[model samples]
Target: MMSDQPNLVTTCTFKGKEYLVKMNIISGNSLEMSVTDKYTTEEWQCCYDANYIENITHKTGNFKQFDIFTTMLKSGLLKTSECVSLDLLTYDDLEMLRNRRMNGRNLCPSHSVHTNNVNSTSNRRYLILTYSVEFDRIHYPLPMEYCGPPDPQVLQGIIHRLEGEVERLQEQLKKQAEQYPTNNTSHISKLQKRIEDLSAENKTLSEDVRYLNKALSKHSNSMRHIGMMKGIVNSLQEQVIRDRMTSHRQIKRLQEEKAVLKQQHTSSETSCSKCSKDCFSISDSKCLLFTTKFSSLL
Candidate 1:
């Protein structure tokens, strides 16, 4: 129901029992009924006697106008803005309301009352008057049939069963959570220890790499120094070979000069002996000539 007006959920107390109901607009009218609960997955369908709906409607002035669930809502009981601030329907009010409207042939299929007994003449004529959707106003109608009231005691039993189920579910959840608490905590701690060990190993590997790099650099410098020394040694060896060859040439030249000096001394001595012999022969010839001249003078 589209309306700017606020809906009201009002509760009425009766006979120390509780029921929940809502008042909301449906098709431009107010509807008040027992609160709808979530459907159960179980194979059982919940049911209430039709007589209960008639008797309660006979008592409360509300929901008298419409017989069906939809019509009652359209009657506009919840249209009043005051309903917004009002509290939810009291359990008493909801029980009474449910007692009146929820059990008609429209909602429940198994009604046992005679059709003629439904809305009898005595039940009519001001049995209960409440707002009706018929003329968009209040309506008065008589009770038609009786499906017999709900056994309040049986309803209480159902509530008790539901409460027990809820308790069992809660206990199971608690036990399961307790069982694995330590296992989860220990698994997390082990993972943390493994991570720490891996980090330490990585640090050690990095240090080793740095040390190897330094050693390689020193070996490279030593190789370069050795290469330079080898070149210097090669140059010194070449210079020594050149000096030895020069000394050998000088010694050969000196030997040749000494042999020439010896040959010149021998030639000069032969020439001196030949000159003395010639002088002696000339003196003999002079003496012979002097003797001839002296004999002629005598």
Candidate 2:
């Protein structure tokens, strides 16, 4: 919901923490969250990643709008903003607000769904906000895109994850390079098998990189989750440095194999002009085998 007036704070309980989640809008272009834990009175500026938003909105669907999650967003989230305007509440107006509204942005779903006893109602604060958006501009707030600056230290986990993945790929490449393909009777089959292995490794590493990027892209999603991983990240960074050095040695080994293949190709050119066609085929296959391997591993 686009509030014409700036900052708003709402108290909420999520994952056992009672927090005052404050959202402030700076012009039409920015949104920032300042959260204060009620018990400890601690405050932090947070990051809410866009990919995580897609997971919540798509998986939860109407429940996202009808539940406490709805409190954070209008019906359409970053894609669209829709809100209802209501008249000011008189004291008696409070008696019926719950009965009249189902829009997700204004009221928490707990109030909407909790059953009442014979003479009592669920007693919770009813917040009704009236806001508007320009549909043509697509100005809905994207949490990370408009996020407030978070403390720089929050990035440690992401840096660790990236380094880990890069090192893992390097190790895999090093192992492949160790099994040098010689121009023997089994050379063709070995080269083909290595190509397939490298291709599969490339695909897997690419996917891992993409997933890590999504998880680390927003501090809001990672802050609570990353704190518990400090021990894990510390070990990973150390392993990455070792793998990088080993991978450099393996790369030199691959280069020696390439020089051997090129020299073999040169010798074959003059050895038998009668079998020139077969020699050319072998040369092309060997060149392709190494080129494909290097492009993917590097």
Candidate 3:
């Protein structure tokens, strides 16, 4: 029974002071009270012993919502056309008249529908709602004397409309959540890991570029030194070749001078040999006379 009932909130006047009434679930005619806001938890106060909230009484002894609505409906006071047809009342007056006539239910109105076929009853308002809606009054054949609140079928329709609204809102929320997917820790971790890997790779590439630049500089220096050495070697080779040519010319001139000296010596030796031959040809007989004359001439 409690599950079928919705918590109700409404304004009530107690001792000329407006207070809020929260019609909480009850057990065996006990009316529960909420003190979370207005009173301390230690107090835990309850004010009524009525089995049903519709039977609750206020300090002012004002008629309960059920009694008021029934009275107004019976008296034709709730018919808007009838209320407005009063020639003296303006629009504002009509609005106030309507509000006054409503008298608003003190507790959320819970009702049941009686099915004739099954002879069973079902709770009309099952959802946990705290408010009521303004439904269009339907024309129903009655005794011409406005009876109590209309048929349970009308309340059931309002309940169905409220339930439909709740369902639609729930579906829309589900669709919205599905449209924007959630981010899990693992996905975030994966992104962070990828970023870290890229950073490391970039650092390694930077180091490699640094090393390459240094190597290039060193290689360039080595190439310059090699070029200088090649130039020196080429100059040295050219100087050595000139010195060799000069030495070769000196050797050729010495060989030519030696040949000329040999030729002069050979001529002198030939002349000496001829003179010796002639001396031998003069014999000893003429030699003695010739030696005496030659000795005198000498």
Candidate 4:
């Protein structure tokens, strides 16, 4: 027959905290554990294989929380208030046992067994059974005791490991501090050399600017001198054209005076020749009359 109640109910201390632990056997002989925090009222469950109970009873298994609970039970740290026998036998095994007992055959000496009452609390009995069936293997009950605090020696070991880690970190910081000054000095020298080179380049650029300004001033004076020379050449050309026009008018007046004088000279010469001829004729007549008078006187 299957029961709804847990096969074992007990209390245990895990990691310095007290908790209520309940162990149940479900169908197929599987074992389950339910753990609850007494102060916080929080609960959780874990199921183990059927072989886990067998391993625990033999005191040989992978050590985990369940193993710690068993260890605490052996050390009288946890207590059990209710205990019941775990039914490990299958249906076939029970049927075979009944048939053998009915046939009047001698009963197996190994199957005959009884439960042992280990402790009592509040009018309750705690029983642990050891028996064997078809497999001929003996099963032992899980040990239990009253609840208590965790051991002090385990806490001391944790604190010692933490102190060693802190010392190692402090040594690393000291080494970094010792190396900083040498790196800082080399970096400052490189920056000062760069500043000096930039200052020399700036001085050379200032000298070139002064030379260009002097050359531009000389060019401006030369352009003004060329403009003054052009104005003088234009005045000289205008004076030469005025002198040529005066010389042409004087030559034309002298030619007209020479022509008038030549005409007057020709007219005077013609009058003089005619008067001389007339005078000669008058003289010849006077002479002729004188000769005739002389002849008459003779």
Candidate 5:
């Protein structure tokens, strides 16, 4: 539900123009605010949720339209004005207006509808029909002060002050122009000297960088050569290991063959000695037989 009466009514200056601001509390504790220009009668309205207002108050939200309002509210620039509340009579009139239609499109007049018959001198007014973006129709009375144009005297005074400010700025500029040449010459010289020094330093740094790059290249080549040498050394070490293993196996086989040859030679010598002894005994037996036969024949 929304309230018929405005919660707050205040006068504030927005964008250098005086405006009448009205705030109403709507459903879910949201705020519906309307701002009407005092001179132009132009109106702008916006609805802010409770969380949105909280964020704006906490400086976390950045709504350009309402940021100035929040600032003015905090700075006491929004002067609170008395709001004419809706009475029973005014409520009945609003109900009737809601039903009544001027055309087929349900258009309402901008003027207020008063039910009471009061004296002509009584300047008290009631609801004025207005339109808002959030609501189709809003009943709020415009303040009397906001209905007319701005004071000419105030505008003239502002113009006069601005003219004086312009003259003062022009004088300041003229004085600066008079003094600029000497200051600029010295500043330019100093800048040129600084630039020359920087250039020299940059040149030195460039040379140093080039030297470091060349040294790095040489070191890289040396590292690659060292890696190649390491690979060659590893290959030679492996070949030496294989040669030593082969030589050890060959030595073991030769030793085994020599031992077998020595055993065979010892057996052959023993057999030869036994055969010679047998030959000598046979020859002696044959000679004795021959001598016995000759003696018998004689």
Candidate 6:
């Protein structure tokens, strides 16, 4: 029932991208607002495990678990606040909350709820609870105290196993040393040969690795060159299309001009024929004599 406010802020730099986070205050613990791209909320009651709570507390020095739990108890904000107020609440609440819902989830003591889509006005979904430290001190159990070292029986068993392994290794070594003593020149020669073989194998491995790396680099460069070539080809294709369009327009204009010249030539021929006919009617014999003379000259 506490007044809603932004409680915590978190920031992280991931792969050169900067992200900011804001926390919300609600019943007793902070809950992440899922509507934001920056921050994800987790229930405080869910992070009661030793490691989960510690990690968040170490990272965020605000709002400890003890503080939140106590606040929740005093304000009757816990799910079992009525039982808690009467001292009737036992460790079952912790067991149930841990085993049931909040087992693996981590809680941030200084997380924010001020992300977009939180719907702070009508939905009331962005609010989170911040518990009191006193309540946590009283309710949250401490880690199991270690009494001393392991039992003597376990220590004896471990030692026995180790001794057995050592004995077996010693026996094997003795047999090997006896079979190929330092005095045996042939054994030394074989050892040297084995060392040389191993060295050759190592060299081969190194060469393979170097060759693979070179091949990968070459392939990467080839891909880059191919991409560049594709871009150039696309640009050339566009230029070709533009040139074709211009040529098409020129061809159309030339065709129109050719049609106009053909029409003019046909009209001139028709006019000449009419004039010749009109002159022929004035004197058929003269026209006939003129045609004969013209034909003879042709």
Strongest candidate by lDDT = 2
On lDDT, the stronger of 4 and 5 is: 5
Instruction: Mark the regions of model 4 whose C-alpha exceeds 4 Å error after superposition.
Output: 1-230, 292-298
* CA lDDT for candidate 4: 0.41
Q: Please give, for residues 135-221, the per-residue lDDT of candidate 4 as tens digits.
A: 443334433332222212322332233223223333432453345343243433333343333333223222222322333335666
lDDT of 5 at 282: 90
Over 4 Å off, model 5: 1-218, 295-298
TM-score leader: 2
Per-model TM-score on C-alpha atoms: 0.24, 0.26, 0.23, 0.22, 0.24, 0.22
Regions of candidate 2 where Cα sits further than 4 Å from its true position = 1-138, 141-232, 271-298
Taken over the whole model, the C-alpha lDDT of each candidate is 0.37, 0.44, 0.35, 0.41, 0.43, 0.38
For model 4 the local lDDT of residue 269 reads 81
Write candidate 5's Cα lDDT for 1-298 as tens digits: 2122456655665436665556676664565655555554444455666566555434422232334434333233233322212221133454455556544456764434333433331332222422233434323332221123222233234334433533443454345445644224344344334434333433332332333333334467644543443343344334334433433444454466667878888888888888888888898898989999988999
Q: Which regions in candidate 1 have their CA more than 4 angstroms from the true location?
A: 1-218, 295-298
Tens digits of per-residue lDDT for model 3, 22-124: 3344453443432111121111123344423344323223334543422332333222334211011223333344455455743432222222412321211
Q: Report the error of model 4 at residue 259, Å.
A: 1.0
How does residue 192 of candidate 3 score in lDDT?
A: 35
Worst ten-residue run, lDDT, model 3? 121-130
Model 6 CA deviation exceeding 4 Å by range: 1-220, 284-298
Candidate 1 C-alpha lDDT tens digits along 81-136: 32111222322333345456666435653233424434442222111224434434
What would the per-residue lDDT of candidate 2 be over residues 1-298, giving only the tens digit for each residue?
Answer: 2222225545555456665455654443344455444554344453344444344445433222223333444322232334523122222245444345534356543442343431332221222333344542111222211122322244454445455565556555566556645443243334344444444433333333333344455666564544434434445545545554554555565568879989999888767775887889999999999999999999
